[model samples]
Structure formats: structure tokens, C-alpha cells
Target chain A: MDYAARNFAAEGYHTTSVTSIVNGLGVGKGVFYWYFASKDELLGEILGDALRSMREAQRDAIAGEPDPARRIDQGIRASLHWLSENRHLFVLMEFARTEERFAPIIRRGDDQMVADALPHVSAGITAGLLRGEDPVFLTMAILGVSGHLARTLVLEQGNDADRVAESVIAFCRQGYLATGTPALARRSA
Target chain B: MDYAARNFAAEGYHTTSVTSIVNGLGVGKGVFYWYFASKDELLGEILGDALRSMREAQRDAIAGEPDPARRIDQGIRASLHWLSENRHLFVLMEFARTEERFAPIIRRGDDQMVADALPHVSAGITAGLLRGEDPVFLTMAILGVSGHLARTLVLEQGNDADRVAESVIAFCRQGYLATGTPALARRSA
Candidate 1:
């Protein structure tokens, strides 16, 4: 899977051949087919595995934490740590997002991410520790902050996970703590 | 440019031929080559034009705003409005980000976006109205928040600009107002 991921990340997924993946690993074609049905299937598995690993890391980090807000902090840090450690997966996911064939798979992963974070956000809102904004909006905003920071600080600039995670946690926590109406002030409505 | 933009947005850039671009508009191939030397050059122009338009909108909205925080608020709304009106361009830009050939083009636009928002953030920091976080970090966070909301509310969910902007502005303002040290509390650092 790592070999396939490396190839897909380095070479465009559409351009990378199944033969290249097997050849790169010095493995027989039969061996490759024995595990995966096709190149597309392999890509799907890679996406699934990456999402599972990420979720596991996030869940493990937040386990036994009773405070919803603090769990959010842990979740952000865990995500950044995972992104930092699996930089290649980030690149692979980026490639996957552009293609129509993989967008649904990517979208599912994204939705699952939001779902995983939803409970904590809901808890915060219920406890009145965070703003009473639409939970989905808050969740996506938190994710956007973390994902972009991970890409900019950890992935591109080679910064450590702790540093990137700190910035993400601080910014997100502040956003959550603010009091505001989620509805827009539309004129001529 | 709109013709080419629409075609590229609808059909993936890598799959869309220059011939198709010209033929779709019922123009001679020379007319296409007259203004641009290659399809890649045309893609760069499309990106630059979009960025210029977005910056103009942001700048115009923030003009004459005395308060740094208000300027930031105006900036976010302006960005959301521009993005709401330019959804197709987002898809094109997403495609551009994945390809190595277009990463530089996208990176330049991203860096320029950060530079444009930096002064307001720096001013807020100096005035002690906002957290004294790294200016780049703050700017990117602000952009990330706006961009994500724009995508989620405006693009995917088909929500109005005013509605999405309200949530983004509220969240960003709170983050900016929070007092926290930007540095991570690294153990054994």
C-alpha cells in the first residue's frame, strides 16, 4: 500500500500504471492481484486505511477526556500529528480530490471527519462552553483551520507537529468560545 | 476568458484540449494563440484574473474602514461574496493545485492572499486587540476559515453569501480577539 501510495503521490494517479506499482515493489503481477482487484480498488483501500488510521489516532488521543473543549484541542493536535507523520498521504489525498472518480471517496472521508468531531462540538454547545453557532459550520471551520495549518506549517515548511498543533488549537478554541449569531445579517431579506 | 474558464471548470483541465477551448467558442485557433502562447499560459492568466478580482473586491470592501477588526470583518465578507459569485473558479483552482505544473501558479495566488491580509492582522496585533500570534499564521487561519465556509455554505450547500459571511466573520473576530501565546508548550524543547 505504501508503494502504491508513493507512486500515486509522486506520479498523478491517473497517469500511474498498475504495472508501475508492482514493478516498483519488485513484486509479481499475480501477487498484486491476489491482494487487490484493480488499481482503483487499491486506491480506495488506501483512502480507507488512511481515514481509519487518522480516526484511530484522534479517538485514542481524546479518550478519557471529559471536557468537550479539551477533547477538541486533543483532536486538532492528533490530526496535525497524523498529517505530519504521513505527509505522503496528504499529497495522495490531494491528488485524489481533483479526479471525478475519487471525489465521492474523498467526500466520504471528509464527512466522516466532520462526523467524528461533531459529538465533541455538540457537547461544547450543550455545556455552554462554546458558542451556540450551527454545529456544522463550527466543525468545518475548525477542520479548515487545522488542515490548512497542517499543510502550511508541517507539510510544506517542515515544522514540528507540536508547534502546528498549538497554533491550530489556540485559534480554534478562541473561535469556539466566541458568542455570535450563526445566521447572516442579510439586507433586503 | 470566461469561455475558457467555463470549459475548464466543466471539463477537467488536463483532459480539455486547447482546440476544444477555441472550438467551443467558435473562434479560430489563431485567435486563441494570439493572446496566449499555450494552454498552460492561458490557465495562469485565468488564475491571475480570478485572484485580481477577488483582491479588488476585498480591498474595495475594506476601504475607508478605520478599525482593524472591522476591516478584517469586511475582508471576510468580501471574500465570501466573491467566492459565492465565482464557484466555478474554485473547481478550476482545485484542479490546478493537484498538478505539479500548476502548483506554482496556485502557490503564488495563495501567498499573495496571505500578504494582502497580513497588514490588518499585524495592526490588530500591535494594537493588542488581537492575539500576538505569528502574522502569517493568523492570516492563513483567517483565509482558511473564510475559504472553507465559502465552500461549505456558498458552494456546496447553496447558501447565500451574507449567511456564510456572518459565521466566518464572527468566528475569525473571536479568534483574533483571543489572548494566547503562539508558541507551543513543548516538553523537553
Candidate 2:
């Protein structure tokens, strides 16, 4: 899966062939099919595994947090950290989004993210810790920021993930939380 | 170049072939060779054209606007409009980003966006129209929101482009402005 993700991230899915996968693995074509039914199926698994791992990480990060705000923070950090580590996968998904074929697969991952995040965000709203907003739309906005910032900061600038994680958490919380006095955290360079 | 962009956007860059372009045009390989050397060369032209078109839109939107906030608003609308019309191109670039081999090509377009916008953002800062911030970082954040929001509104949810564009402009401007003010614009629905 890593091999496929890496290749797909690098050469693009349509450009990468099963032959190349086998050649890179120093294995026969039969060995490839023995594990997976088809190249498309294999990629589906890869994309699945990549996103699942990310979702799992976020869930694990927030498993012990008592504070809703802090839990949101941990979730953002966990997501950004995972993306930084699996940048090749990030690149793969980015490429996949541009075509008719791979877009549906990518959307599945997106829908999964909204489904997974709704409970936490809704909880925040119920707790009176967050603003009354559509949990799904808020989730989408946060996801948008997290993914884009992940690419811009970690992938593009090669910056420290921990610090950028702080910013992500801050912006996300601010974006979703209800304004008591509603103050934007001033960013320091 | 339009043929290549449309093909790359629709079928994906790697899946698109010289034969397909020629066949669609009812021309022979010799006719194709008469214009471009290879698929890669053709993509280079397409990406360049895409960037140029977008840059022009941004430039035109901001030309007569005096307020930087309003200018960004217009710029966001321009971006959304372009993406809506050229959804295929966005998809193509998204696919390209996933592949390492194709990413360099896409990155060029990404970089062009930041480079082009930096001056305007810097000007905003100097004019005290925008929050005092690092132009590059601010540029990325602006881009991060714009690109993701565009994908959601124009590509994914199929929302009205004008409405989404306004939301994008508001979200980004509020995020970037020197405001400790609450985000009055949080989505309720």
C-alpha cells in the first residue's frame, strides 16, 4: 500500500502501472494479484488505509482529553502530524482529486471525516463551548484549513509541525467556537 | 492548449494521450507532431495558460477597488467563478499534485499564485488595510482557505458559486484582518 501510495503520489495513478509496482517490488505479476484483485482495488485500499490511519490518530489523540477545546486541539495536532509523516499520501490524494475517476474515492474519505468529526463538534456545541453552527459545515471548514495548512506549512515550507499545529488548533477553535467576547488569537511570527 | 487542458482536466494528465487528442481532432500523429513535441510539453503549456488566466482574473478584480478587504472579496469571487467554469482544470491539478512526477508542474502554478498575490497583500499591509503580518504566511493562509473553499463550493457540494465565493471572501478576510473581533460569519446552516 505504501508503495502504491508513494508511486501514485509521485508518478500519478494513471501513469503508474502494475508492472512498475512489481518491478519496484522485485516480484512477479502473480505476486501482485495474489494480494489484490486489481490495480484499482489496490489503490482503493491504499487510500482507505491512509485516511483511516489519520482518523485513528485523531481519535486516539482525543481519547483522554477532558476539555472539549483541548480535545479539538489534540485532534488538529494529530491530523497535522499524521499528514506531515504521510506527505506522499497527501500528494497522492491531491492528484486524485483532479480527475473524474479518483474523485469519488476521495469524496468517500471526506464524508468519513465529516461523519467522524460531527460528534465531537456537536458535543462542543452542546457543552456551550462552541458556537451554534452546522456541525458538518464547521467540520468541513476545519478540514479545509487543516488540509490546506498542512500542505502549505509542512509540505511546502518544511516547517516545524508542532508550532504549525498550534496555529491550526487556534484557527479551528476560533472558527467554530461561540464568541463570548470572541477574540482572535494574535499570531506571532 | 485548450484541447490538452480539457483532456488533462477530464481524463487526467497521465491518462490523456497524444492519440486521444489527435483522434478527437480527426487529425493524424503528424499533425500533432507539427505543434508539440510530447504530452509533457503540451501540459506545460496548459498549466501556464491556466495560471495566466487566473492571474488576469485576480488582477482585473482588484484593479479599481480601493479597499483591500473588498479587493480580496472580489478576488475570491473571481477565483470561485474561474474554478466553477474550469472545474476540470482544478481536478487535473489536484490529480497532478498526488503524483510526484507531475507535482513539480502543479507546484509551478501554486507558486505563481502566491508570488502574484504577495505584492497586493503587501500593499494592503502597507496601506494599513490588512493586518500587519508576514506576507508569505498570510498569502498561504489566504490560499489555503480559497483553494479548499473553492473545492467544496464549486466542485463538491455544487453550491451556488456566487454565494460560496462571498463566504470564502468573508472567511478569509476575517481570518486575515487585524481583528480581535468575533467571527460574526460562522455558518449556522
Candidate 3:
């Protein structure tokens, strides 16, 4: 699976054949077919596993952090750290999102990701740490903020995940917990 | 080009062929070949034109809005409005982001988009209408927020663009212009 992932990241899914993947590993086609049904199925497994591992990392990172806002910060940091380590999965998932057959899979993965964050966001709203807003929208917004920062800072710019996480944590803390005073009001004060 | 865009959106770029596109349009191969050197080139043109139109829409929407916060609001609404109108183009652009050949083109379009939002964000910071922060990261965050909302609300949920735009405008107003109080500080206050 790791072999196939690396190839897909480097060569793209359409261009990477099962034969090529096996050839790169100096193995027989039977070895590949024995474990996987086809290239599409294999790619699906990779994408699914990638999402699961990311969720696991975030869950583990935030475990025992009682403060909802702090848990969210830990989640964002773990997500970025995981993405930095599994950068190849990022390319594979991006490709998965484009194809018709893969769209449902990627969408499911995204839905699950949003689900994982939903509870923390809900807790924050309940505890009044975050603004009393719709947790669903806030969860989605939090994921968007983290995903964008991960892509630009860690993947594209090769910045340290911890550093990028700090910036994301700050932005999202402000975004989710801001007092209702308008900028005009604050400026005048 | 319109025909190609529709086909690409529906069938995806990888599944789409020059022959199929020409056949759909009831045109000759020579007509397509004369305008575009290859299918990749044709798709690039379609993608480029779509981006330009969206930018043009945004520019037109925010043309006379003098306030920076209002300008960002106009930009988000304009973007969501354009995305709602050009749903097919959105699919195509998502596909474009996956391909090696198209990644640079999409990146350039994205950079141009960030560039468009940067000036207004900077203006907001300068005018004390927004919290002073890294404009580049803030601009990307704003785009991320708007894009995710548009995808979930307008495209997936069949909500009206204006309705989603209202939600996005409110979220971003607080995101960009929040008072400089940490969540911990607010919680204690």
C-alpha cells in the first residue's frame, strides 16, 4: 500500500498501473492481485486509511485535554503534523476528489472528519468558550482553516508543522471565540 | 468552449476526449485543432476563462465598495454567486487541481485569487477595521472559509447563494475583525 501510495503521489493515479507498482517492488502481478482487487480499490483503501490515521492522530493528541478550546488547538496541530508526515496522501486524496468514482469516498472521508471535530466544537459552545453558533458550520470552518494552512504552509512551503499549527490555532481561536463588538466599535474605543 | 466545459464537468477531464468534444459540438477536428494545440491546451483555456470570469464577477461586485470589510463581504458574495452560477466550472476546476499538468495552472489561479483579496485585507488592517495579522494567511483563510461554505451549502445542499453568502459574510466579519482578546481572556471576562 505504501508502495502504491508513493507511486500515485509521484506519477498520478491514472498513470500509475498495478503492473508498474508491482514492477517497482520487483514482485509478481499475482502478489498484487492476491491482496487487492484492482487499482481503484487499492486507491480507495489508501484514501480511507489516510483519513482514519489523521483522525486517530487528532484524537490521540487531544485526549485528556479538558478544555474544549485547547482540545481544538491540539486537534489542529495534530492534523497538520499528520499531513506533513503523510504528504503523499494529500496528493492522492486531491486526485481522489476529482474522479467520479472516488468523489463519494472522499466526501465520506470529509464528512467523517467534520464529525470528529463536531463534538469538541459543541463542547466549546456549551461551555461558552466559543460563541454560541451552529457547531456544524463552526466545525466545517475549523477544518477549512486547518486544511488551508496545512496545504500552504506545510505542504507547499515546507514550514514546520508546529509553527503552522500555532498560527492556525491563533486565527481559529479568534474566529470561533471573538466577542461580538464590531471592529468599528473597537477602533473608536 | 462552453460545450467542452459542460462535457468536462460532467464526464471529467480524464474521461473527456477531443473527438468526443468535437462530436458533441457537431464540429470538425480541424476546428478544435485550429484553436487548441491539444486537449490539455483546450482544457487549460476553459479553466483559465472560467477563473477570469469569476474574478471579473468579483471585481464588478466590489467595484464601488469603498470600505474594506464591505469589500471582503462583496468578494465572498460575488464568489459564491459566481460558483453557484458556474457550478460546472467548479467541478472542472476541482479536477484540474488533481492533474500534474494542470496543477500549476490552478496554483496560478489560486495565487491570483489570494492576490485579489490581499489588498482589501491590508486596507482593513491599515484602517484599524480589521485585527492586524498576517494578511497573506488571513486572505487564504477567508478564501478557505468561503469555498467550504459554498461547497456544502450551495452546491451540496441546494441552498441559495445569497443565503449562504449572508452566513459567510457574518463569519468572516468576525474572523477578520475580531477584538484582540484570547478565548481564555473572553471566558474569564
Candidate 4:
């Protein structure tokens, strides 16, 4: 699965044939068919595994964290770490999103992410730790920032994951305003 | 070009052949070859046009804006509006990024975005209107938030573009912290 995923990420998923995967693995056609029905199924399984593992990482990172805000912080850090470590899978997921056949799977994972993060976001808002915006919107913004930064800064630019995570967490917690400056009342108005 | 872009965005890029594009448009293969040398060339032209138009929108929206912070806000609004308007091209861009052959074109456009936004971000920091973090990183975070939110909220959820843009700008400007809360000093520590 790892080898196939790397190949799919490196080569276009459509371009990477079952023949190539089996050839690269030094396995017969029978061996390939015995494990997976088709290349599409294989890619689906890879994406599923990647998403599951990522959710697990986020869950483990925030486990037992008492503060809602800190739980979100830890979740962002853990997500970045997972994305950096599984850069190939990250690429694959992006590619999968572009295809109609695989987009539903990606959306399911996105829904799951929102479901997982909603409670903490809601808790933070209730505790006055987060902005008084829709919790769902806030959760999406957090995911967007962390995911985008991970792709651009960490994966593409080779930045340190921990440093990027710190920046992301700080941005999520306080935004772009300089310290001591009055928080812009644009929204309140 | 519009027809081809829509087809490519609707069907997978790899699956959408030049013949199909021409047939869908009721044009002969000769017409397609005369205009675009290949399917790859056609997709490249579509992406280039989309990026150029998006940049132009941002430039026009920020025109005559004196405050760097307001310019950033205007830029985000313009970008979200453009993305919502041209969602098919946006999906095509995402798809193009996954392919090795087309990824460089996307990267060049991304580099141009950074160049365009860097001055505004730097000026904001210098004026003490933005955070003291790396200007480039801040810019990327802004882009990430806006792009991701547009995809999730406006495009997928069918939210109003203006409202989504307002939320994104607010998040980028002040973050998730509620008004009057001391901006967390986690970074300082």
C-alpha cells in the first residue's frame, strides 16, 4: 500500500497502472488481484488509511487536554506533523479531490474533521476563549490555515514543522494583529 | 476555451481528451489543433488565463487603498469573489496542481501571488498593524485561510460570497480570540 501510494503520488494516479505497481513490487498478477480488486480500490484504500491515520494523530495529540483552546492548538500541531510526515499521502489526497470518483471520499474525511473539531471549537466559544462566530466556520478556518501553511511552508519550502505549527497556532489564537493593539472592531460594527 | 475548461473541470483532466473537447464544442479536430496544439496546451492556457484574471481582480479591488491593512482586506474580498465566480477554473487549478506536468505552472502562479501580497504584508508589519512574525508566512496563512474557506464555505456550502469574505478577513485580521481578550502571549513565552 505504501509503495503504491508513493507511486501514485509521484506518478499521476491515472498514469500508475496496476501492471506497474505489481511489476515494481515483483509480484504476479494473481498476487495483486488476490489483495485488491482494482487500482481504483487500491487508491481508495490508501486514501482511507491516510485519513484514518491523520485523525488518529489529531485525536492522540489532544487526548486529556483540559483547555478547549489548548486542545485546538495541540490538534493543529499534530495535524501539521502528520501532514509533514505523510507528504505523499497529502499529495494523493489533493489529487483525489480533483477526481469525481474519489471526491466523495475526500469530502467524507472533511466532514469527519469538522465533526471531530466542532466540540472543542464550541467549547472554546462557550468559555469565551474563541470568537463569537459560528463554530463550524471557525473550525473550517482553522483547518484551512493549518492545511495551507503545511503545504506551502513545510512541504514545499522545507520549513521546520514545529516552527510552522507554532506560527499557525499563534495565528489561530490571536490573528495577525500586533500584540497590545486593540482588536479590530470591524466585525462588532 | 470556456467549453474546454468546463469539460476538464467536470471530467478529470486526464479523462477529458482533446477529441472530446472538440466534439463537445461541435468543432473539428482541425479547429482544436489550430487553436491549441494539444490538450495539455489548452489546459495550460485556461489556467494561465484564470490566474491572470484573478490577479487583475485583486489589483483593481485594492486600487487607491492607502492603508496596507485595508488593501489586504480588499484583496481577500476580491479573491473570494473571483473564486466563487469562477469555481470551475478553481477546481481545474486544484487538479492541475496534482499533475507533475502542470504543477510548475501552478507553482509559478503561486509565486506571483506571494510577490503581489508581500509588500502589503511587510508594510502592515512595519506600521505595527500586523504581527511581528515573518511577513511571508503571514501572507501564506492569509492565502490559505481565504482559499480554503472559499472552497469549503462558499463553493461547497453555497454561502454568500460577501459574508464568507467578511468572516475570512475578520479571522485574518484578529484571529479566533473574542474581543477584549488579552491576545495570548504563548509565542512570547
Candidate 5:
């Protein structure tokens, strides 16, 4: 699975053939067929495993954290760190999003991510720690910020994932306004 | 261009052949080749034009707005409105990002977008109206929130573009913290 995923991420999914994968590994077609039905199924499994692993990282990061806002922060940090380590999988995920046959897997993973984070968002709002915006939108906003920044900064720009995570948390928690500024003060009023 | 873009968005880009596009439009092969040299060139042009048009909309929306922060808000609203209207092109844009040959076009367009917004973000930070974090990261955070939200909410979930824009701006401005909350107050302190 790792070999196939690296191939898919380096070469386009459609361009990477099963023949090449088996050939590269010096394995017979029988060995490949014994494990997976087809290339499509293999790619699906790759995506599912990647998403599940990412969620696990996030869950582990936030475990035993009592503060809702801090939980969200730990989740963002965990996500960025995982994404940085699994940059190849991240690229594959984006590529999968573009294909129709693969979009369902991506969508399901995204929905699962939102479901996982929704409770903390709700908790924050309930405790008056977060704004009274729709919890789903707020959750989506956090996902958007973390995913996009990880792609642009960590993966593409070679920036440190931990630092980018810090920037993301700061932006998510306090937004653009500086501390005690008139604009922020007025908005708070 | 419009016909081809619609087809590319509906059918997968690779599946939509030049012949099918010409046949659907009731145009001869000569007429198609007269404008574009190849199918790849046609899709490239489509993606380029869509990005250019979107930027123009943002520019027009923010024209004569003196306040940098308000200008950023207008820019986000303009982007959502444009993406909602030209959703087909947006899908095509996402697809274009996946292919190796087409990734440069998307990257260039994204860079142009960041460049356009960087000045305003810098101005806001300089004026103490925005956070003193790296201006580039702040600009990317805004883009990330607006783009991701628009894709999930407006494009997929069928939410109103304007309403989504409001949510985006509110989040970008004040983040996830509620007004006068102890979390926010403590952060400021």
C-alpha cells in the first residue's frame, strides 16, 4: 500500500498502472490480486487509511484536554504535523478529490472529519468560548484554514509544520484584529 | 469556450474529447482548431480566463474602498459571488489542479490572488487593525477560509453565497471567539 501510494502521488493515479507497481516491487500479478481486487479499490483503501490515520492523530492529540478551545488547537497542531509527515498522501488526497470515481471517498472522509470536530466546536460555543456562529460553519472554517495552510506553507513552501500550526491557531482563535485595537474593541462592544 | 468548459465540468476532463465538444456545439473540426490548437490548450485557456475574470470581479468590488479591512471583506464577498455564478469553472479549476501539466496554471493563478490581497493585509496590520502575524500567512488564512467554505457550503451544500460570505467575513474578522468572552479577553491580555 505504501509503495502504491508513493507511486500514485509521484506519478498521477491514472498514469500509474498495476503492472508498474508489481514490476517495481518484483512481485507477480498473483501476489497483487491476492491482496486487492483492482487499482480503483487499492486507491480507495489508500485514501481511507490515510484519513483514518489522520483522525487518529488528531484524537490522540486532544485526548484528556479539558478546554474546548485548546482541544481545537491541539487538533489543528496534530493535523499539520501529520500532514507534513505524510505529504505524499496529502498530494494523493488532493488528486483523488479531482476524480469523480474517487470524490465519494474524499467526501466521506471530509464528512467524518467534520463529525469528529463538531462536538468540540459545539462545546466551545455552549461555553461562550466561541462565537455563536453555526457550529458546522465554524468547524469547516477550521478545516479550511488548516488544510489550505498545510498545503501552501508546509508542503509547498517548505515551512515548518509546527510554526504553521501555531499561525493557524492564532488566526482561528483571535482572527485578524490585533489585541485591544479599536476595531476589535468596537466589535466587542 | 463556454461549451467546452461546461462539458469538461460535467464530464471528466480526460473523458471529454475534442470531438465530442465540437459535435455537441455543431461546429466543424476546422472551427475548433481555428481558435485552440488542442484540447489541452482549450482547457488551459478556460482555466486562465476563469481566474482572470474572478480577479477582475474582486478588483471591481474593492474599488474606491479606503479601509483595507473592508476591502478584504469586499474581496471575499466578490469571490464567493463569482464562484457561485461560475461553479462549472470552479470545478474545472479544481480538476486542473490535479494534472501535472495544468498544475502550473492553477499555482500561478493562486499566487496572483495572494499578491493582490497581500497589500491590503499588510496595510491592515500596519494600521494595527489586524494581527501582526506574517502578512502572507494571514492572506492565505483568508483565502483558505473563503475557498474551502465556498466549495463545501455554496457549491456542494447549496447554501446562499451571500450568507456564506457573511459567515466567512465574520470568522476572518473575529475568529472563533465570542465577544467579551474570557477566552478572548485573556488572549488579548
Candidate 6:
């Protein structure tokens, strides 16, 4: 999957033939076909695997957090940490986003990400901790902020992933936190 | 340039051979060569034109704004409008970002974007109208947030780009507005 991801990421989807993928891995055609049904399926698997990993990390990050705000922070950090560790797949994710055939995978992952974060965000709002935010808008905002910051700080600049997470928390607090507790937003999610 | 942008944006950069571009236009290959040196250079030109258009929109949006906060709002909205109008090419931009060869153009555009927004961010801070911020970090965060939001809301969803821009502005204000805002602590950028 890594090999395929790197190839697809390096070469656009239409350009990266299954032949190239197996040949690049120095494997026979039969070996490639034995495991996967088709290039499309193979790419789908790769996408699924990436999403699973991200979800797992998000789960692990927020596992013990009692506070909604802290859960948000942990989730952002986990995502950034995952992105930092798995930089290569970001390219594949990037490629999947453009082509029509692959958009579903990207969309599914994004939707899942938002769904996972929904409880935390909603909980904050209910507790009068965050703003009266539209869940979709906040989801998109979190995704945009976390993904971009991951790209800028963790991926490109090699900044401390922990520090970047703090920034995510801070930015979210600035926009989402209700009036009070200017130091670090408290949460009940 | 528009012709090439459409082709590359839709068909993609690598799949878009010189032959396809010229043939699609019902022109001889000679006509293509007459204007551009090679396929690579043509792609570069298309990208440059896109960037130029976006920059112009941002500039025009902020043209009459003296207040740094309002200027940033205008800049974000103009950018979102450009992204919304050119959804196809915008996807192409993200697609193009995967390849190394096309990276320099993207990077140049990125640098210019942050640099363009920095002066306003700085002025706002110095005038005690905004939060204390590290200019580079703040600019980068805003770029990350706005770009990500633009990609998700304007380009992908094809919804109200202007409304999304308002969200970006509100986000920036929450993070950057120095004095007139209530306590919302812990900003990332």
C-alpha cells in the first residue's frame, strides 16, 4: 500500500498504472493480481487504511479526556502527529481529492472525521463552553485548520507536534470558546 | 492561457500532452509552439495566470480598506470568491501540489500570499487592535485556515463562497482581535 501510495502520489492516478506499481515493487503481475482485484480497489484499500489509522489515533488521543475542549486538543494533536508520521500518504490523500473516481474515498474519510468530532463539539456548545456553532461548519473549520497547520508546521517546518497541537487548541478556543477563562478553555465534552 | 488552464485543470497536467491541448483547440501543434516553449512551460503559465487572477481579486477586495481587520476580511473573501469561481482549476492546483516539479510555482504563490497578508496583521497588532501575535506564525495560520476552508467550502462543496469567507473572518477575529473581544484563550497561530 505504501509503495502504491507513493507511486500514485508521485504520479497522478491516471498515470500510475498497476503495471508501474508492481514493476516498481519488482513484483510479478500475477502477484499483484493475486492480492487485489483491480487498481481502483487497491487504491480504495489504501484510502481505507489511511482513514482507519487516523480514526484510531483520534480515538486513542481522546480516550481518557473528560473535558470536551481537551478532547478537541487531543484530537488535533493526534491528527497532526499522524500526518507528521505518515507524510507520504498525505500526497495520496491529496491525489484522491482531485480525481472524480477517487473523490468518494476522500469524502468518506472527511465525513467520518467530522462525525467523530461531532460529539465533542456539540458537547462543548451544550455546556455553554463553545459558541452556537453549526456542526458542519465547525467540522469544516477544524479540518481546514488542523490539516493546514499540519502541513505548515509539522509537515514542512518540522515543528514540535505538541506545540502545533496547542496552536490548534488556541485557534479553536479563539473562535469557538464562550466568553471567559482566557487562559485555556475548559471543556465538558 | 485560459485554454491551457481548462485543459490542465480538467485533464490534468501530466495527462495533458501538447498534442492533446492543441488538437482539442482545433489548432495545429505549430500554433501551440508559437506561444509557449514546451508543455512544462505552458503548465507553468497556466498556474501563473491562476495565481495572478486570485491575487488581483484579493487586492481589489481590500482596495478601500484602511482598517487591518477589514482588510483581512476583504482579502479572505476575495480569495474565496476566486476559488469558488474557478473550482475546476482550484482542484487542479491541489492536484498539482503533489508533484515536485510543479512545487516551486505553488511555493512562490504561497509565499506571496502570506507576505501580502502580513502587513495588515502587523498593523492591527501594533495599533493595539489585535492580539499579540508572531507575525509569521499568525500569517501562516491564517493562510492555512483560509486555504483549507476555501478548499472544503468553496471548491469542494460549491456552496456560498462568500458566507464561508465570513466564517474565516470571524475565525481570524476570534484569534486576532486584541482588545474588543471577550476571553477566548489559547490560539494556535
Best by TM-score: 4
- lDDT at B51 for candidate 6? 83
Candidate 5 chain A minimal-lDDT segment of 10 residues: A180-189
lDDT over C-alpha atoms for residue B19 of model 4: 83
Docking class of 6: acceptable
Error in Å for residue B159 of model 4: 0.9
C-alpha root-mean-square deviation, candidate 1 = 4.2
lDDT, candidate 4, at A60:
99
Interface RMSD of each: 5.4, 6.4, 4.1, 1.5, 2.1, 5.6
Candidate 6 local lDDT, A1-189, one digit each (tens): 888887776666667888888888899999988999888889999989998998998999899878776677778888988998888787688877876777878988988898999898888667666666575677667777889878777876789877887767666657422233243321112
Encode model 6's per-residue lDDT on B1-189: one tens digit a residue: 777787777766665788887888899999888999887787777788888888888888898878776677778778888888887668777876777777678878877888888998888667666566467667777777788888777776777887887777776556422333344445344
TM-score of chain B of each: 0.88, 0.84, 0.91, 0.95, 0.94, 0.88
Per-residue error for A146 in candidate 3, Å, reads: 1.2
The per-residue C-alpha lDDT of model 2 at residue A32 equals: 90
For model 6, the superposed segments whose C-alpha errors exceed 4 Å read A10-24, A175-189, B175-189
Candidate 3 residue spans exceeding 4 A from truth: A176-189, B175-182, B185-189
RMSD (Cα, Å) of candidate 3? Answer: 3.8
Stretches off by above 4 angstroms in model 1 are A15-22, A27-38, A175-189, B28-35, B175-189
Instruction: Assess every candidate by TM-score.
Output: 0.87, 0.85, 0.91, 0.97, 0.93, 0.88
Chain B TM-score, candidate 1? 0.88
Per-residue lDDT of candidate 2, residues B1-189 (tens digit): 777678777776767788888898888999777888877777766766777888898889789877555566677788888888888777766765665656687788788888877877777777666656456666666677778877875678898788776655545544322234333332212
Quick one: best lDDT, which candidate? 4
Instruction: Identify the superior model by lDDT, candidate 2 or candidate 4.
Output: 4
Please provide, for model 4 over A26-118, each residue's C-alpha lDDT reduced to its tens digit, 9 standing for 90 to 100: 989899889998888999999999999999999999999998988999999999999999999999999998888999999999999999999
Using Cα atoms, each model's DockQ against the true complex is: 0.33, 0.31, 0.38, 0.77, 0.63, 0.35
Tens-digit lDDT track for model 4 on B1-189? 998888888888988888888888888999998988777898999999999999999999999988888889889999999999999999999998898999999999999998999999999999999988889889999999999999889988899999999999989888898877775556324
**Count of clashes in candidate 3:** 0
Candidate 5 per-residue lDDT, tens place, A1-189, comes to: 999999988877877889999999999988998999988899999999999999999999999989899899989999999999999899898877766788889989999999999999999999988988799999999999999999889987899999899889988987887767644322110
Model 1 error, position A187 (Å)? 11
For residues B1-189, write the lDDT of model 5, one tens digit per residue.
999998888777877888999899998988999999888899999999999999999999999988888899999999999999998998898877767889899999999999999999999989888889799999999999999999889988899999999889989988898867644322212
lDDT of 2 by residue, A13-94 (tens): 7778999989998999999999999987887788778878888988898897676655666777888899999998887777
